[model samples]
Target: MNPIRRRPHIDYELDAGGRRSLWQTLPTLTPGLGVLRHYERRWLRLDGFAGIAVVAYMVPQVMAYTAIVNVPPVVGLWTALAACVVYAIIGGSRVLSVGPESTVALMAGAAIAPLAGGDPERAIVLSSALCLVVAGWCLLARLFRLGIIADLLSQPLLVGYLAGGAVLMVVGQLGRVTGTDVEGETIVAQLRSFFSVVGDTHLPTLAVAAGTLTLLLAIVILRPRWPGPLIAVAAATIAAVVLDLPAYGVAETGPVPVGLPLPHLPIISWADLQTLLLAGLGVAVVAYSDNTLIGRAFKPKTEPGEKSVPDVDPQQELVAMSGVHVAAGLFGGFPMSSSGSRTALAIASGARTQVYSLVAAVCIIAVLFFAGPLLEPLPSAALGAVVIYAASKLVSIPDIKRLARFRTSELVLAIVACLGTVLIGILAGVGIAIALSILEMVQRLARPHEGVLGRVEGIAGMHDVDDYDQATTLPGLVVYRYDAPLFFINVGDLRRRALLAVEKENEGDPDHPVRWFILNAEANVEIDISATDGLKALHDDLSERGIRFGLARVKQDLRTPLERAGLVELIGEDMMFPTLPVMEKAYLTWAAEQAVREQTALEHQAVPGADEPAGTPPARPVDTNESDR
Candidate 1:
C-alpha cells in the first residue's frame, strides 16, 4: 500500500532520514518556521489567492455556525484558527476545509444540554467527553478498517436526512436573523415571537445581516471563488463601525487570539459520557458520511492516465476526522467536521493538493494576529445568513424529485425528516430519519419472501410454485424455500408458512398428499430459540401425520445450533443433506421404497381373496378445525 502523507505541509528542514520518523512529527512544529515556509514558497501567488479567499468566507461562516450551537461567536473563530493549524500537518484531502460546522456544534450542544445547569464549566466538560468518544471511536474503526458502515447510510437516506436538516437549520436561524434570542426546539416557537418582537428588531443589525446574506448568496451563484463571506464581514464591519451599529444593539465578534493554542484535555465524567453517547454517534455518522463523500470526489490523482480514483479508505478518514475534533475539544476550540461547502469551494478554485489546507492554515494565523480587529462589527444577521446559506445547499429539490421517481417510501421518509427538522431540532430530525430507515429495513427482513419451489416448463431451475405462472409441482414432494434468517421477529410467520405449505399440498390431492417436505435452507444462516421451537412443533405434527421431512443446503454454522437443540437427532441423520443434488437423490430412493410398500399392500389385499377391496383407499378423517383435524 502506498503511504498517505500524515501532514499537508511540505518539509524543508527535515532530510530523508528525519522525514522517516513520519508519525513522530507534530503540527506544533514552530510558528516562525510556518511563516518562513509561507513566504519562501515559489507557489506563493497561487496559494495566497486561495488562502485569502478561504479565510475571507470563513469569518462570517464561522460566526454563523457558532450562533447555531448557541455558543459564543468567538468559539467558531477559535475553532477555525486552531483547526487550520492542526490539520495543516495531519490532514489528507487537498480541498477539505476543517472548521466549525452547524451539524457538529448543534450535535455537541444537544449531547451536553442535560449536563448544563447554567454552568459553562459543566457544558465544557461534557462537550469534551463527547469529542473524546468520537476520537476513540474513530481510531478504533480505523484499527478494524470498518469503512462499510459509512455507506450503510445509503444515498436515498442521506439525501432525505440532509434535506430535512437544511430546512430546519434555515428556520432555526430566523430568530437570530430577526435579532431575538427567542430559541425554540421547533418551528412554531421560532415564528411564535415574531409578532411581539418585530417592533424590537434592531434595524442596523438586521440591515447588516440581510446585506451579508444577500452578498453571500450572490457570490455562491456568481463568483463562488471570491470569498464572499470574508468580504461581506469586512464591508459590514466597516459599515457598522461607521454607522455606530453597536449602539443600536447590534452584536459583534470581539477580539480573538491571533497566535497559537496550548492543548489541554476536557474535564469529563462517566455520567457525561453516558449522556453524550447518542449525540457523539450522530457526529460520527455525519462526519464520516461527509468525509467519505469528499474523499471520493478528489479522484486521488497519482498516475496520469487512470480514469478512476482509488476507493476511499473510510476507516482512516474517520480516524483523522475524529482526531481533529478531539484536538479542538481539548484546546479552547469547539467541535467541527469536514466543511462540504468549503471543500467544494476550494476544489472549484483549482486546489490540487492537500497543500491548500496547509496554506489556508497559515492564512488563518495571519488573521488571528493582524486581522482579528477587523471582525469586531460583523453583524449577527450576516453570520445568520452565512449559516442559512451554507445549510441551504444541503436541501436539494432535484434529489427529492429523484427519490420520488425511485420509491415513495424514501420520499416519505425524506419529507418526514425535512418537516421534522423544522418542527423539532436538527439532531432530532436525523434521529427520526434513521429510525424510519431502520424500520423500513426491518420490515423487509421480517417479511422475507418464502415460496414453494416447483419445476417450470421454460425455466431451467425450480421456481416458486405460487409466484410463477407456468410451474409444475413434483407428484408428492412439497418444497418450501425460506429466503431470510430465522429469528424471533418472524417465528409466528414461520409457523404459519410451514402449516400453509402442508395445507396447500393436501388441497391439491388429498389421496396423494405430499409424503415428504423438503426445506430449502440455502438462506437460513442463523436461527434463534423462538424460530427453532416453531420448527420443532411443525416437525412433530408432520411426523405424526406420516409425512417425512428433509433439509437441503443448510449453512455450515447452522449445524451446531440444530444439533445442540436435538433438532437434527429428531429429524434423523439420513434426512438432512448438504446440497440440493444430494437431497434429490435421497428423495428418489425414498420414493421407490414408498411405491414398493403400496404395491405390497395391494397384492396382500388381492391374495386375501376378499380380505379387502383393492379399489378402496385408506380414509382420512374430515375435519375443519384443530379439534377435528
Candidate 2:
C-alpha cells in the first residue's frame, strides 16, 4: 500500500466521534508542528521579513517592559524567547506574539515588591515562581474548560483598568525620566516624593528622556508602521556613546550578562508559594484575557475554502499558554502576556505562520549572546521613555467618550474600576471589576424591561404599546412580556408589573375591565421555585378579579419546573398555549361569550315586570326536557 500524505491545511484539531488514535491526536495538539510539517517555500520570505520587523520592535520594547517587572533587562529577552517559541509551537492563533506585556509586568512587580523587600535578585526569583504558579493555574483552567473566564473582564473594565495602569506606569517612571530617585509605593505618595525632589532633576537624563519620547511620539503619529521605539532607543544609544552622557550624570543600564540561562526550576519556599498564589491567579486572568483578545484581533484572514490557518480555539489557547508560561518559568523569566505592538508589527510586515516567531526567537538568542555589551551604554531614561510611550497608548480616551455617550451606567462601572485600580491596587481592581459585573447582571435581572404588548396598525405581530402611538390593544385583554428569566430576585417585579397592567386597563375603561391577562413567556426560558409560586399567586389573584389568566409561548425548560412546582396544573392546560396567536384566539372567543351574556342580562333587566305599573311584554315559555324543531 502507498503511504498516505496529509494535506497541508487539514484541520486535525477537530475530533469526530473519537475516531483518531492518540498518536494522531498528539501531533494535532501542537499546531506549530503541523505548520512545520506542511511548511511552504513561498512563505519563507514573508515570514522572514515579518520576523525582522518583530525583532526590531521587540528588542527595545520588551527591554523597556522590564522596568514594569522591576527585573534586569536581560530577563525580558528570556521571556520573549520562551513566549514566542512555546506559543508558536502550540498556540491556536498563527500570528499572536506573546512577550513581556506592560499590564502583566506591572502586576507581577507589584505582587513581588513587598516580598522581595527592594532586592532585585529576590524579585527575579519570586517573579519566576509566580510564573510557574500562573502556568499551573492555566493548565487547571484548560483541564476544566474554563476559557469563559477570559470574558469575566468586560470591555469597559478593560478600558478602565488599562487607563489606570497607564497612569500608575507614567507616574512610576517619573523618577527614572528625571533621575531624581523618587520614593513611594503608591501613586499619591510617589507624586509627593516627585514634587519634593523636583529641584534635583538631572538635566542630562531629562533631556535624553524628552528627546526619545518626542521622537517616539512623532514617529508613531507620522509613520505608525515603523519601529518607532526601536529607532528612538537606537538614536539615544548612539547619542549616549558619542557624547559620553553617563559622565554627565545620565545613568546607563550598566553591564548586562550575555547568553541565555539554563532551564531549571525556580527555587522558592512554601511560604513564598502561599503568598504568590493569589497574585499568580490574578496574573493568569489578566494574561489570558490579553492573550485571547490579541489572538482574536490578529487572527489571520484566509480566502474562502482555504484552511491555511485554523480558527482560534479558546481551550487550545489555554493549553498553549500553559506551556508558554512553563517555558518562561524554567528560563528564569517573569510572567508574560501577548504583546499588541509586536503582533501588529508582524501582521503589517506580512507574517504567514509561526515561523516568524521562530525567526524572531533565533534573532533574540543572537542578541543575548553577542549584543549584550552593546546595550551597556543604553540610557535608563531611554528605557523609561519607551515605557511611557507604550503606556500612553493604553488610555483610549475615545472609547471612554463613546461609553459615556451610549451607556452612562457602564461608564460609571468603568470609572469605578479605574478608581479602584488607582486608589487600591491592580489585584483589588480586578476583584472590583468582577464584582461590578456580577452586580450589574443581578440588577438587570431583578428589574428587566417589561411592557404591555399590542398590535400596531401596519406592523405584524406585537410590540410594546408605549413604543407606538398607533398601537391598539384588545377591548378587555392585556398581554405582558418580561424580558428576563423568572427567578426569585425578579419574580416579584413580574407580578407587580402584571398587576399594574391590569390596573391600568381598568382605570382606562371601568365599564369593561380587563377580562383576560396573558403572559408572553417566550423570553422567560427558566423558572425557579419562587417564581413558579409567584406565578400561581398571580393566577389566583386574577381569578379573584374575574380575569382569566393564560400563558403563551412557554418553553419546555420553564414548563418542566412549573409542572414540578404544581403551577402548570393550577393554571390548567386549557389556559396554556403553544403560541401567542392561539392564546389570542381563545381569549377572543371567551370575550364574545361574555359580551353575549352581558347583552342578555341587560335586555332582561330592561323588560317590564308584572308587579310594576307599566304593561308587561308577552312571556315565552320554554320546556326544560322537550326539544323544539
Candidate 3:
C-alpha cells in the first residue's frame, strides 16, 4: 500500500470532555482579526471610494472641530489619523468612523481650559493626558462588562445633549463668523454679546460665512451623498485667495504645520491626573454613549446565511475605543470619539469594512505631507460656517416633536439637559442628563405598576383585572402581580400595594371573602433582603387574618434568595408553585376543604349542643400536608 494510505488512521477529533486552554481560545477574543480574514477583492473599489470621500469630508471637518477643542487644526488631523487606524484594527463596527466629535471636543476644551491657564501647549498636553485617563476608564468598563452604562442616557437625554452642543457650537463661532470679539459664559450672555456686536460685524467675514453655510446646506439637501464640505471648503479657499478676503477683515487659518506627527508621552503630573479623573470619566461616558449610538445606527446589514458579518459588540467597542484613545494620546492628539456625520457619509459612500477607515487614515497622512499649505488660505469664517452646519444637523426637531407628543416627561428631561448644557457647561449638562435618567429609573422602581390579575372568559391566560370588564376573579382568591423587581427601594411600596389589593377585594366582594392571596411573581425576578423581609411580614399578616398565601411562577433565582433569607420556611415550600395553573389547582383544593370546615361548623351551630362551642369547631392541628395534596 502507499505510505499515505497505509498510515494508521489518525484520530483528529477534538477532545469532547476536555476543557479549552486560554491560549487556544485567545484568537477568538479579537473579533476584528476575524473580519480581516475574509477580505474580498470586489469590496476594495467601494471601500476605496468611501475612504476618499471620508478623507475629503474629514479634513475640513476635523479642522472645524479643532476650533471647538481650542486646539491647533493640525492636532485634529493627527487625532483623526490615529483614531481611524487604531479603531479599524480593533473596533467591532464596520462603518463607524472614529475621529474628533463635536460633543467630546467641546467637553475636552471645557475640561482642559481651566487647568491649562490659556497656554496652548499646556492645553494640548493636558488634553492628551485626559485622553489617556478616558482610555483607562474605557478599559475598566470593558473588563467589568459594564457596557450597559451606555443605557444611562436615554434617547431624549441624547437629543437634549446634541441640541445643547449644537447651540453652543453656533454661539461659540458667532465671533469668528462676524469678525467681532463677542464674549460670554452662558447662552443668554452670549446672545446679549452677539447683539451688542451686531453693529460692528465685518461685512467681508459675514458674507463669507453666509455663502459657505448656504452652499453646504443646499448641497446636503440636494445631494446628501456628495462631498459637500470638501466642495464648499475648496470654493471658499479659492474665493479667499483670489479676492484677497483677508485684506477685507476676513481671518484665515494662516499656516498649518506639515508632515507626520511626532509620538510623545503626555507631560502631565500625578496632580494633574487627580484633577482630571472626574472630567475624564465624564468624557468616557459621553464618548461611549455617542459612539454606541452611531455604531448601532450604521452597523452593516447582513445577507441571508452570512456567517462573516460581525455583530455590534458593545464591550468590544469599549476595548477598541480605549485602544484608539491610547494611540491618539501617544501621538500628540486630543480625545476623540465616533463622528456621526463622517460615519453616515462612510455608509452612504458604500463602505463595506473597517478597511475604509484604514484607507482614510492613509489619505489623511498624505494630506499632512502634500496638502497642508493649501489649507492656509481657508477662511476662518468659512470654517465656522462648516462647524455651525455640522452642529445644526445634530438638532432634530422631528425627534423633539415626537418626544413631546408621546412622552412629555422625557421631553422635559431632554429640554432640561439641553438648557443645562447651553446655560451651564457641557460637563454639568451631562451630569444633569445622568441625574435625570437615574431619577426617572428611581421613580419607575419606586412606583412600580401593580395589577390585580383576573381570568378572562375567552383568554388563555390571566390579565389585569381593570383591562377587561368581562374578566372575573376567583371566588375566594386574590391574584396580585407586581411588575418590577423587589428591592430595598420599593419594598415598602410592595407591602403597601399587597395590603391595598387585599382591602380592595374585601370591599368589592363581601359575599365571597378572599381566603387565599397569590402573588404572581414572574416579573419579580430579583429580590433584596428588605424585600424578603417585607414578603415574610406580608405572609404573617395574611396568616393572622386567616388567609392562605401562595406564590405563582416564582423563578429559581428568586427562590434561592428567599430560601437564604428564611422566607421560604415562613411561606412554606408547598405554597410555592411553578405556574399559575398549578397554583390555581392547589388553591381550589384548599378552598374546597376550607368551605367544608366552615359549613360543618355552621351546621353544628344550627343544631343545639351539636358542638361544645357555637359557630366554631374544635381547633385541629394545622395540616401542612393538605397543600401538597
lDDT of each: 0.69, 0.87, 0.86
In what order do the candidates fall by TM-score, top score first? Answer: 3, 2, 1
Residue range 1-629, candidate 2, lDDT tens digits: 98998867856765433468899878767988887888889888989999999999999998998887788889899999998899888988888898888989998988888788778778788888999999999999987889998888888888898888888889889999999988778888989999999999999999999999999999989998888988999999999999999899999998898988889887888988998999899899999999998888886545589786656778888888789889999888999889887888888888888899999999999999999999999999999999999898889999999899989987988999999988888878878887887888899999999999998987889999999999988888899999999989999889988998899999998887887789999999988888888898898888888777888999898888888898778777888999878988988876676567666555656674644455766344332112110
- Alpha carbon deviation, residue 343, candidate 1 (Å): 3.1
Please write out the lDDT profile of model 3 over residues 161-216, one tens digit for every residue.
88998988898899989999876666688799999989999998999999999999
The segments of candidate 2 whose C-alpha lies over 4 angstroms from its true place after superposition are 1-28, 301-310, 597-629
Query: Distance from true position, residue 545, model 3, in Å?
Result: 2.2
Could you say which candidate leads in TM-score? 3
For candidate 1, the TM-score is 0.78
Flag clash pairs in model 3.
none
- For model 1, residues 1-629, the per-residue Cα lDDT tens digits are 99986878766774323233534543322322333454435445655566666666676677777666665565666677667766655555545677777666666665565566536545655655676777776777765766665765656777777776676677667767777666444557656756557787766667777888787677767976677777766777777789887787877666544555566777666776676666777777777767777667763233377344345445546656766777777765666776776776765655544566667777766766786667666676777877877787777889889889999987877777667755666667667766777777778778889998877787776778777887877677888888888888876787688778898789988887777788888888999878788788878778777677778888778878988888898787888888766777777776776677667666765565345567665433322113111
